[model samples]
Target: MGLIHLPTELILLILPPLSESDLAHLLRVHWSLYDIILPYLYRRHLQGSRDSTGNGRNEAKGFFRCIVTSNTAGVQRFLDFGADVNAVISAAEIRKANFRSTGFIPWHDTQTPLNIAASMGDDTLVSLLLNHGASVTGSRNHQDARRAVQPAAVDALLSNHESTLRLLLRRASPLSAPNMERGGLLNCAIARGNLPLLRMLVNEFGADLNATWQEGVYPLNRAVVSSGPEAAEIVRFMLDKGADAALANGGSSNSNGDEESTGGGSQRLLDQAIRHGTIDTLRLILGRGVVDPAIQPLDTGNNIFRTWIIERCTPETVHLLHEHGYFRALDSSQDDTLMIAVRARRGDILQLFINSGVVVDLNARLTRGGSTLLHAAVVRCKPVREAQAASSIRCTTMPSPVASSDVPTVRKIEPEYSREVLSRRCMSEKVEKCAPEEIVRCLVRGGADVNTKDARGISPLDLAEKGPEVVYRILVDSRCE
Candidate 1:
């Protein structure tokens, strides 16, 4: 008699001890065996091999192994037998499977087989899974489902698996999901400068071209800050799709009650483009006619132009802004310009300002501290590495000095001035090629007052006491009284 004709109890008892491969052989032997054993195999697969604790499920381990091995037939068998397509790979299972090196993290503890396929850049497997109803929305948690789809889609795009990305986008589930942080799928595509996938998302998937993410940043804003030749094409595509080039986050809600801005957004976009040094993106934004070429968005506490100069952004980017008249939008106060350059330790930008015919008030005292640019530069000068090393050694050998009430406490400078100085120091870790001495000479040549003092009577020479000997020598040689 056929095994199928045997008592159900006999078949169930016999099947429990067989391996997955053995079951596959039996499945081929008869359709009756396939019907009886397939569901049983699926149930066992779902239950997984229990550990000593008998409480843990390693379903994801087998799934991960199947993916790593690219055993398409093995995977198909599991799916055909009704495996939970959306089951998550736990961090523990990932470790056990030796896939730790792949850097896969459980997305909300619900990373599906499809996410793994996408991340592995397996277009065929990804297609196969999607065809089998593998969800792009991995988990069913309504709140987390949307967030989960984003990372998976991003992985496919970042891996340059265009076919996989296209498959995910073709699914209605991913299309219906909300955008995640950093401007969601469209923004992610723009950030990677993937024009073809970007086009597919907009034209085929019907992705909302104007969707905003954290801080109400639009995809256009993200594109403006991204690097790559495809950036220009992506920007054009976004613009063609009726993206608002001037949309700004005014810290208010839109009609949809999502945090978004209808006005003043373009200026912020420009600032980001400058900050990231994307010259092509910058040109695209300016040429759109939404943002006035003359509008200068103040860097506020931190001058974006000064930041660009400090980071040594391409001269073309700086010159483009200057050529378009955006550079003139900076605060007209000469002291502000010079002090910004000095605080940034950007002698290059400072010189650029001078060469651009911008007036430099070398001896002008800051509004709050009453300290000249020279005083600020000297006080902010960090000691050389060798000096710091020697000082560290001396501290280990010398006894600690007790605090004395007789010692005068250094006066706290204005909050803005103190903040600017501290922020610059915290951001830059490496020493610059232009020494404090060179900066001092630059200021002196520009007619800075060598003896200029702040409101507390701290002169440039006095501030030099806190710096290296070279700084002090430069100040003293400049004839500080």
Candidate 2:
């Protein structure tokens, strides 16, 4: 090996990228990888593979890898030449561990060789390192030619330590602080959705059940995003570990985590699950009862419930929330959601709310003075007919109309309220605009006076000027007396 200067080593590093040789050659620069990398790559390639598929082919292919492992002969010879299997950059560790948090890892964001090996399905190389006494406990073992183990690296070691992984539980600190990734190896295992691995992390490695990760996310949050109830149990583990009923789901402090943009990753994951219409995941998470609903990202103003609505959470789920007292907060003196739904012309969802005990005024609008859901639809500029169509909810189609066996006790709501609901909807909804006649008929049905106008004198019929005059004529023809 004619390799001589630090500059030559740097040049050697650059040469791999420049040369036709596979990139693994540069990684082999680490004396420790001499025997380890090669056998590991080979073992992985043949880990679960079939017969006659011997060393030659995989060895040749691995030679062209980004992190090259050599032939067994070369590896054994290099090891025979006396390479240290464990090279600790002690200074790097001490500075990193002391200056930062106690749980800092020198290579926190990057994966360890074992992690990469595991990720690539390399079981042999994995076992090889374990056999050779490679430091299996931290991110890396550079001792500045010294020794120390931060909690983060210890977690890494345990994460990859097949036998030691689950047995290290007694070593875990109960400070509620996790190393490296907040929730530490436990979240990683949970994120990977490995029940056995998570069990090992919990029962043996001593991972904090309530430890938060990346953001203020917990293992339960990660598990719930998935479809299975198995993930939900991670939260239960925390609960068993003396975690408080409320750890997270929404709302977070930067001191405990990093500052996320308004509607950041946490919000997005929850939103995506709804957006994709996975009610199973939603129900599983909501059923767990630990998530906080009040943590609205102040900037986006998109509360979790609204996100669900925007993502079109099923009517069944909405009813479940209503039953469980979620929508009670929104059912204030002026039901804003009714106005919002009206503006969007989501008469189906609106009626669902009404059926679920949401107070529906023919003119329920936000503070902006919207009138009937019809006016709201009109104001939002949706089509007059399709938008104004009521009794459109499908959930209770058989009994949807709620006719008191045909009619109610004959209480008549004013058409002006219809106009206000429509107007409030205009202020809140974002669907297409409406034609004059459709708006007029919707108001008329809801009991609006066609000729009635606000202080400015612009009535539903007056606003029909934006469309054809026939619409106005039709409104006049059907005008309420």
Candidate 3:
């Protein structure tokens, strides 16, 4: 027996690495080696107990530390000494170990050896203990890390040298849960706006896309708020991967799980994109068949930006919306794009619509009946007012009429009809819809009719009956009486 068959201790001292199983097998093979190495192993592990205070720390008897930091050979030789395999459970196991320290445990604050190792992201030590059936789920550092891995942990696993992620997954541990943080994985991606990670979780791990379905919301809704061009692409991926329009539609599904409304689910997504100024994401979503010329968002999707672009609009976004097939001229004339822009109050955007030759139907206004541009403008106004105001008048070149007053000059009547908006008013049910007298006065200045009755069939004066005499008096002074 040459050097190849040297004594076991000699073999371990000379060999570079030996596997844990080999060590365990070696222990069973030679009773003599166990006697010689056992005390040595005990002395080596004693160092791990220096910080531990109790008897568990004082016991200081384990084989776990010998193989803990070894590449392989030392582990086998140490195990041959009949070392306690699960030394990670003891303090004596910690000091002798070469793995990183797990942080302070939040629960009992008793930092276990495994806690020290795991927080350091040492995959080898983790593997060694896990192979020896070490407790993987015990409280280690903070409960956050002890119980679960957060984005930071995920980042560490993916970017760092640690292989714990694969280990956790291989062991089939829970990837995430709602209360942990950011509603767990899918929602975390949504909140962080990490499109690529979102794709991975959906396609690779099959994360629950509808985890927060109770709120009638989803990561896709959040995607609309994202600014990236690929944000829409991410949404499309989610839809293809089984994202439900019903799940994203708060207005569509009631608690009963039936379709309450139809057709503009994707349109709402696009409209929200416009509202948020997420043009890139908007283009990507519009590329889907949902916003095809054959199908339109109609009113809910009838964005004010489109209205403005139709009239005085032309911006990179408008051009992009057009190229992306958001709107069609429908003839040389019936373009609704500029109309959308005007209503959206892109007054600067209105210029784009006019230059592009978008036709403005004078009667086109917000559903409540202001000019279309004004309707869109009101909704787009920031720091919302009683009626957030935004408007632009659109007119075309009339064929230069023969220069003569006798030619029956046509006088275009400005819209002056005003309905009191009582949505924010403190008025009672009967008079609640009544517009404020001050707003009524502004409307009057803009040439609105003070006599217009709301659905309640009462004029502004009748609605003001409950107010101080000044309420009725304002309307009267404005000549609304």
- Top candidate by TM-score: 1
> What's the true lDDT of residue 77 in model 2?
35
Displacement of residue 79 (Cα, Å) in model 1 is 3.3
lDDT of 2 by residue, 1-481 (tens): 4433344445434432333234257446776544444444444433322226432211221211211231334433333333333322232322333422322233333333333233333345444444555444443244232233333333333334444442223333222333333335655555544566666656655666655656656555565544333434554555566643334445444676753344432443344344432354455445664432444221134544564372244455555546545565333353456555555445445556655544544443334443444444444443445444633643563556644562222112111234333322101234333443444445455544555454454555666555445555656666634
Q: On TM-score, who's better, 1 or 3?
A: 1
Candidate 2 lDDT for residue 21: 36
Look at candidate 1 and give me any clashing residue pairs. 247-265, 248-265
Query: Order of all candidates by TM-score, from best down to worst?
Result: 1, 2, 3
Q: Which candidate would rank higher by lDDT, 1 or 3?
A: 1
Superior by lDDT: candidate 2 or candidate 3: 3
RMSD of 2: 18.2
Prediction 2 TM-score vs. true: 0.49
Against the reference, the lDDT scores of all candidates come to 0.63, 0.43, 0.44
How do all models score by TM-score?
0.64, 0.49, 0.42
Of the two candidates 1 and 2, the one with more favorable lDDT, higher being better, is 1
